[model samples]
Target: MATPTITLVTAVPNPATFGQSVTLTATVIPLGAGTPTGTVTFTITGGPILTGTLSGGTTSVVASGLSAGVHPVVATYSGDNNFLSSTGSTVIAVVHASTTTSVVSTPDPSTLGAPVTFTATVTPVAPGAGAPTGTMTFVIGGSGGGLFTQPVTAGVATLTLSTLGIGTHPVVAIYSGDASFLPSSGTDTHTVIPAS
Candidate 1:
């Protein structure tokens, strides 16, 4: 007769940020003597199915690229000839990652009507991994000034202009948060002098 077995599941960093990898471990314990030998199948709701080979009665799998939401995970132990099958479950919560934006203008002090390029770089805060995706809104010269939007490519957005009135312009770059990243903003100052 096959011996009864118990399975238990646990997740490291239960509350993880989007794009962060999560480790899932399944432990199989035999009700009777001896360790259970076999494999474990992990099923993640809204994610992917992973299979792991049991080692010393425990097996682990790494999961990444999870969207921001609650995911239910189930671990099924594929019992050996001497052990009966068992199952365990756990929950993982993924939240949006925070980001920081920094803006820079080339040719800080330039002549009026000269092309000036403004660049914005967006980076994820600590504990968050991967590049952020979304659009960037450039607000030039405070309120009522020129407003331009650009798509972010590899965590960067840029805009070029040469029509600013001669003076000091306060430029702000606003990042439009995506499903995996939170919104952020940065500022820069550009001075335009009469064509020299």
Candidate 2:
């Protein structure tokens, strides 16, 4: 008389997408002279267009091709070939490729040097949520954004260029995303209120 043993392998992706490869391995192996052979079947759980019957082994299939986006790869083994064997299964998720971030510049204030506030937003081209996790650099007249780095409760960002000298001071805000998102200002002015 013999007893049937089976174990499931966790820590695997679900519903793997198309155009990807996956591997199935056995786990929760009991300590003993367990029979290391039997009839193992590999199939996509709850998925269509996937079929195959594989042999038994501790670990099989270096990598198998699949469609994409979370393909469940199951590996099963029959314990009849050995004195004691455990049925094991694993799943792997395969997903499509991700494209690079595509961010554009928002309309900045035309005038430069003026004590005008502005907000530079970065948007990704992909159909996802949340803003791109990156830094938005704000530079002013060959100098760092001293106070510009200040946080804004709302969504808008403010840039204040104090009344320095005169000339056409260039007040620009550069957004730092993947590479660099620089939305510059044309030419804001700093009207020097004549000191009486």
Candidate 3:
């Protein structure tokens, strides 16, 4: 009779971001013996406990929706008939994700040479996540039409154009990323028709 020992291997990406999904993999190894099979339970501190069936001695699970902080994760292998149970652990740090950028152009269809205001709003992922401060590049009618920059104040930036070509213009607003927040952009269309 041979005494079987099991070794557990766990892998997870560290320094993750909030609302980011990551795959956690665990492998079970049997020392000087045959293959190991069964289920592996992955427990994440301040998160959820997930279980996955072992396929060819390997199992993986996707973990998401974690809060912003350091989370300790452990993988425990359920022993099969030929092997003993083992456990492995690791730590993951989740930071705040990038904020969202939403832009709106007033008077979508307006007469040429009229005033059009483009308002860009940057919203953080969660409340108290902090406001994003940077330059907002406003481009109208692609790259060649018009380009300008505005300072983001209190998660809001605005740009107004008094003159635009008489046609469909594609407006793009890009928010320059800052520390603690990633860059984001938004697009909208403004139609300028001929005056009566």
Best by lDDT: 1
Model 2, 65-170: lDDT tens digits are 4434454556555555443555555556554432232212222322333354445444433321223334444545533223245332212344444433433334
Predicted structure 2: clash tally? 22
Candidate 1, residue 62: lDDT: 97
Local distance difference test, candidate 3 = 0.79
TM-score of each: 0.94, 0.35, 0.54
On the 0 to 100 scale, the lDDT of residue 32 in model 2 is 53
Candidates 2 and 3 compared by TM-score, better number: 3
Query: Per-residue lDDT tens digits of candidate 1, residues 16-46?
Result: 9887899999999999998898999999998
Q: lDDT (CA) for every model shown?
A: 0.92, 0.40, 0.79
Identify the superior model by TM-score, candidate 1 or candidate 3.
1
Per candidate, the number of residue pairs that clash is: 0, 22, 0
